[model samples]
Target: MALLAQQLRTPLSTINALAQGLIRRADRLSTHDVQVKAEKIWRASLRLDELIETILSYTRASAGGIMLNPGEFHLSELIKRVCREQGGQEPDRPFHLDVKDVPETIVGDPILLEQALVIVVSNAMKYSRPDQPIDVTARGEDGMVRITIKDRGIGIPERDLPFVLQPFFRGRNAKKLPGTGLGLSLAWYILKLHGGNLEVESREKRGTKVTLMVPETNTTGLSYSI
Candidate 1:
């Protein structure tokens, strides 16, 4: 709770200060200046929205209110879309995608899958250096598909690796970073909800690799349960 409050305050303060500045300086500020500040405000609001949504997901899932709506969708298109969106935010960093071997279509909730991918990709960007690239690779394995996101960032500590998927669990090295620490936990939950699995392999100072495994068909036999 304290961590959540502290993280939320930073963005809220930015939004509040920028909004006030824009209103107060409307008469004197140049169009370009206004645009820049407005953009900052918009980005800060997005950060706040992500934080809120993550909290709600944690709460909802705990109460067994989360449900999966699986269906067939193009996996390549989804990967490309996520990379495009994330790349725009980190224009200096590159996202190399290799999904040719993955099935063209898979069965799952597209919206939820996208959210999980965003969490992983965004974390890769945030933890790694601006010059380092993010590698996303996917391939078929029997009836399942494996999507891997690898990053050349300060990897997780060996001791912390075991707890990385636990809610609100952050690595000692990542303590200085900006995050609520719920992303991996939520992403893991989403995968498990689809009868899939999330795996992580990392060596401190080397980098980290996250693999998401999902079936090509909705064989989980789960329904709209709350």
Candidate 2:
């Protein structure tokens, strides 16, 4: 978790500047710069929010105190929202969202699901080359909803695949990365709570593909209204 906190270092600096301005001269912030700075503050705060969400996922899962507020929503829309949130983080990069035969609405804890998807998507981006494209796609079949996050980046070794879901366990290839390896673990815990599963496939020199599988809602199996 301390390693994850490192991601917020840059944002925290901007936040400090904003706070100092507001503290010393609230009146002189003016309308234009105030709005711009406010937006900066908002973005920085969101980074903190992501950190809190990721940490709570681990703490909540470990305590067996995980909970959900189930609701109905379009899965593709939720995917789009997660991509959009992350898109801001890497404004220069693009994520190809290929959704097909997706249900219009499904029942589940959207917040938790979104967090899980964000983890998968962010990892796909982080582990891959910035110049490469990350793919996000979804489809419903049989009794399940399957979402795939594919990246054409450095792949995980077969030996490491078995341990990737273990808390704080990063593959040899991932050791150079900054994460403490909590993302996949938290994602697995969330999916397990929802009767879902997270799976991965990769090669050393090739790329990797992660699939998130969950059972379809009783009322909407493989059927989409829009």
Candidate 3:
């Protein structure tokens, strides 16, 4: 975790400096595109802040004392926010959000949900080709809100897929990728705490898809037990 934190800090600091510079010169920018770029920079810096917090939270949870602050929020909005946060740097590989079917709201910890989705989506972008599109879809069914993230990347080997969710475990194909291998594990824990499960489907050389199924409500039609 220390290594991961060190690796992330440098880039985050650079982004922070860049964002500040842009903000200082915001009035001098003449074009709409320049202003948009400045906003993206600032948002990206904020996302890095959230990611850093998430890493700390996961570390604290693994130490066995962290608790969630649950609430109600729109699943679609959460997904969009995570995608926007992570995809800001990649302007070429457009994110295609397909909300063909989904619920307006669900009960869960918004911060935790956002962190999990950020992990999955960040991994998707990291492994996928620059020109390939990343797909995010949400749907409500059988009292659950399911969010799926798919990327056209070098897929995991059949034998290694089962172990991918384990903490600090990296696959043969993932050795070259820059990651701590804690994202999936953290995501799994977050979903489990929300009474949800994570599912994966992939074919070697084709692509990979991860589906996070979170319960919409309890049997008594309440968000939490009394």
Candidate 4:
């Protein structure tokens, strides 16, 4: 929760500063400048919402209260949306998505699936250099859909790889970075709830790749109410 408070501070500050700036300088600013500032504020608000939702979901997941409302949805569209949104937040960075081999549709809870993808992609952006590209690729294999996110950033120490998905467990090299370390843990739980799994591979200072696999059909009947 302390890290959650820390993460919230950034977007909250952006929203407050931009709002106050617009209030004081709207009369002197150009219309285009005002529009740009408003967009930044909107994006910051969205970031704040995502951070809070992630924390709440993590809490619910830890309590075994999360559920899956599985249904059919376009997997490609979902991936595209995550890349687009994440790229928008960090315009300097690039998110390259490749889904030609993936099925057009898959059966699962789209909302939760999207959240998992968002978390992974956001992590890629956070650790990677702004100039580096984040690659997201999706494909179908052996009755499951595989989505992988790759980044050229500060990779995890081999010893830390096993605990990367554990809540509040940040890599020694990543300890100084700004993150709560709950995103991957929450994302892994979401995938498991949908009869899926998460995988990670990394090398210190090289790069990292995380893969998420979910069955093409919701046969597990995993559902809960909270």
| Best of the candidates, lDDT | 1
On TM-score, the stronger of 2 and 3 is: 2
Better of 1 and 4 by TM-score: 1
Candidate 4's error at 124, in angstroms?
Answer: 0.9
**How does candidate 1 fare on TM-score?**
0.93
Clash pairs (backbone) in predicted model 2: none
Of candidates 4 and 1, the better by lDDT: 1
TM-score of each: 0.93, 0.77, 0.76, 0.87
Tens-place lDDT digits, model 4, residues 40-133:
9988888788788978897898787777787899999999988997898778887777899988788889999999998999889889888999
- Most accurate candidate by TM-score: 1
The TM-score between candidate 2 and the true structure equals: 0.77
Q: What is the lDDT of residue 47 in candidate 4?
A: 75
For each candidate, the alpha-carbon lDDT, in order, equals 0.88, 0.79, 0.77, 0.87
Candidate with more favorable, higher TM-score: 3 or 4:
4
* Model 2 per-residue lDDT tens digits across residues 138-207: 9988767899999899889988888888887888987876565788888877776667789989987688
- Which residue pairs in model 1 clash with each other? none
Indicate the residue-level lDDT of 72 in model 3: 75
> Mind sharing the TM-score for model 3?
0.76
Instruction: Please say which candidate is ahead in lDDT: 1 or 3.
Output: 1
Q: Better model by lDDT, 3 or 4?
A: 4
What would you estimate as the lDDT of candidate 3? Answer: 0.77
What does candidate 1's lDDT look like per residue over 1-226, in tens digits?
9999999999999999999998898999999999999889988998898889888887887677778888889988999999999888767898889999998898888888899999999888888998999999999989888999999999999999999988889999999888988899888888888878899999998889999988788735342221
